[model samples]
Target chain A: MTVHTQHINMTRTPLPILPISLGVLFLGTAITMPFWGQAYWLHEFVNISCFFIFAMMWNLLAGYGGMVSVGQQAFFGLGGYFVLAMGNLAGVSPFIGIPLAAILTAIMALPLSKLAFRLNGGYFAIGTWVIAEVVRLTVANISIVGGGSGTSLTAFRGVDRVFRQHMTYWIALTCVVATVALILLFLRSKQGLALQAIRDSEVAASSQGVDVIRMKLAVYVVAALGCGLAGALYFASNLRISPDAAFSVNWTAFAIFIVMIGGVGRIEGPIIGTFVFWLINHYLSDYGTWYLIGLGGLAIVMSLYMKDGLAGFIHRKTGKDFLSIKRIYRSK
Target chain B: MLLTVENAHKSYGALAVTKGMSFSVEEGETLGILGPNGAGKTTLFNLISGDVSLDSGIVHFNGQNITTLAPFQRCQSGIGRSYQVPHPFGNMTVFENLITAACFGGQMSEPEAYDVAEEVMNSMGLTSLANQQAGSMTLLNRKRLELARALATRPKLLLLDEIAGGLTEPEAQELVTELKKIKAKGTTMIWIEHVVHALLSIADRLMVVNFGEKLADGEPMSVMNDPEVKRVYMGIEA
Candidate 1:
């Protein structure tokens, strides 16, 4: 008699047809938006896309990499300045300068990681903030790029206002899609498994032959690249940049709020959180201080009740992940 | 010698954790290490595994000097170790944890890693808990997972640190049985344990360490009967 032993196969959630269909439909709408959408809607789309890109970057850094950085705006602001400098001084188109700015920001992150990694836990968060402030102060002193007062991006000077807005909107949408795709692809790779292992236990990860420092550095640089692209696209949309506005700590604060309200570690959390945040901002901005207070209260409640954020709560309840990269083992 | 440590010394400020300890092991031998609490048994394991750098000494593995290599580099070079505290990646599934070790430490390809991880889990009797999150496992199962993870690296030399430290008698016996199976496969191992019976059951040779120095070394039964070992380690009339 011949006997067969049981076998096990590990698989990620099979690609859901419903979500894919809806995603395709959404992409269709986004692509055709400029044809029928008003200028105001385009502006809103650009704003939402920029915040979403920034939130995704922060989520990848802190949620997955376990590096909670409060100074990510340093790269964001630097990207804005790079775009302005390239366009006005170096005669590069602002559109062309956006990607170059992101690449430069990634290179800068390599050295900054050397400094920031010296601190651990809460000290690391504060260290990054201090570095961001130093960048702001140093940029403020430079007479070029308009210093503290900032400068207008002149690369769009020959272009029509409508055409400029359309181009900026397309770039913002591309960035949002690219950010999601990049993070999804990364989390599915072997390096992604190593990264989560490090997050769980650095000593165990090292014992398993993972290069902890190198992985952390890679995540840091990738996050900086995303933030840089967001910042460049944001200023390009606005047509102007200032040291205070571009380098504002509020950027990181908003990103934290979005990631926290959505979910800390899950990919879907930020997308849902950004929409909720945008709704509150749109309806309640007129209330001024009360709006900020309401947002803070909501954040506290979400953190207390839904520790993993809204998406996490949904995931726990339903046990379904639309963008899960985790492998699921089944007996065969 | 498959592995050799020459005058390995490690000191933490005024506290000398490992003081000029020297030892060697053959290609397929199992060496049991015994010591009282705070006797630097774990420190010796750390030095050999490169988890902690030696203050001064040379460590050779497979006839290659590996004293300056990083912990991960040591793991890649086939030195696998289990922690006393059982540090499995808490959020990952047991299968995922094993696969991580297989892919990185064992340098196996994805499909090969999966196969090796499955085999290790089955051998460790951890197949049922494969999909469960590592942190949710009970202490005994967690220890099993720790051993399974180290084994997934396919190490030429396995360093088992206190694998039988905190188990009931029956649990320790079960672990010993599992360990004997590994030994029967001719995998070299250095086990540090407070449980004397479990250590003696499988160890061909034994070494006792105290005060950062070797107190005794020889065949397990003879070492246990040594008058000096009895006086210092067993605290009995010799």
Candidate 2:
């Protein structure tokens, strides 16, 4: 029963100081933005946070879990509508409704996943989109939630405009922090290792005793909750909700582009991708149709030449993952 | 008996891969399986491991009826197997690959899983490649990983499928040496291999299968010498 174990040590690569310092500095600046920065700046930050969080979830589901879904907007729309319902009808504050709506939206994924799980690969992706459309149509027909015309969020009627903006900004910031922290913790845990293994090969993972179905379902639900939160947060700021706007496939499309351009599977990919997206959107968005065409073309070029995205390309060239999730062995 | 399969039958659209196959292995026995390329050896492994459902039969492991259990459930119940074509978790490091098996298959806690992974790596000569990505390894290392991963599961019964298929003579000999160390540990093993000398070197008994049926079963040398086994497997004039 004896085996050699005298010299080898098992450990994860230590987190480097550079990214940690930069992250703290960024958080500090973000946290103080409402006090020192202009209202427009705060609004932009909220928008950026929503896009980043949504893209991150998509990355988790597709990049890590290997379930490429094109129908996440179903939950995103549900989140927006739920928050609006609770606020306009039930008298709950829109701010409190965000998380409550997100949880309820995640619960909705359970039954939908049963149907979605029945399809795999390309069919799964298309099936999700179909499910989203069904949800959109069903919600549109409900007169209470405003039907196809939709409803505007009225819970902010009595609140001061500046205070509400500040509160919304902080809440969005909090979500970004939580999403990053929780997903990071999950990826570093033993379950995360099992998840990546499942992604690489489901048959092989199952032979190693991983419950592939359960793992995939868990990931799908988590992504649903995250996307829901992003949706709720987004409409809360815009103060408007409509079936077409909320359930648009463009939400998932943009997230896909970001994940593809940043990196498909790495944590850092979404971050870089989101920033690049914001830059193009801020500057080139004024070009209208040309801007849309440019975005599509860029995605195609990136997929063709730099398939790894920006972060993956850097890792290949430098052999360094700035935020490494790999384990290392040291000999004592 | 540690493992038994009774009256197993499987077919795909009229092609019967396994037909009423039945066998049993005692505790601490190394049973080697021999057959031609299309003799349904891998299909038999799949049925026993719960990867492929039997058309009609019963699989008993440690006296439990496991015919209807899922593959992962079977693995957790102490049955571990390697695919004929090695399927390592490509992006994960070799150490991480073993850790995945040890954690879920062996049902060990994180620290205990690390210990098992490290031990298996040491014995399997994978310690030096602990940090190397599993996908990028040479074929020999990947084959070693295939065996090391199954070993990390700490199974009561191990099923190895053609683990020595694509290796050179010296490399296969090295693998046989490592396997000898494992067999000495008294683990029950069912090995499907075309490398006759390697199988004969370790197996306590041998079974020959063709057309999904057991053709010969007994001592390794005698089974190989059987006229029927020679005619079917070796294509010899009977």
Which prediction has the highest lDDT against the true structure?
Answer: 2
Give interface RMSD for all predictions: 4.1, 3.7
Query: Per-prediction TM-score, please?
Result: 0.96, 0.97
lDDT of 1 by residue, A1-332 (tens): 11112233655556566766888898899987988999999999998888888999999999988999999999999888888889989899888888899998888888998899999989999999999999898888888888888888888888888888888888887888888888887887788889889888999999988888888899999999999998888887887998899889989999999999999888898988898989988899899999888988988998898888989888889987778777655554
Task: Give lDDT: candidate 1, residue B1.
Answer: 92
The global C-alpha lDDT for each of the candidates, from Candidate 1 onward, is 0.89, 0.92
Pick by TM-score: which candidate is best?
Answer: 2
Candidate 2, residue A151: the lDDT equals 88
Going through the candidates in order, the fraction of native interface contacts each one reproduces equals: 0.66, 0.74
DockQ of 2: 0.58
What's the residue-level lDDT of B107 in candidate 1? 90
True contacts kept of 1: 0.66
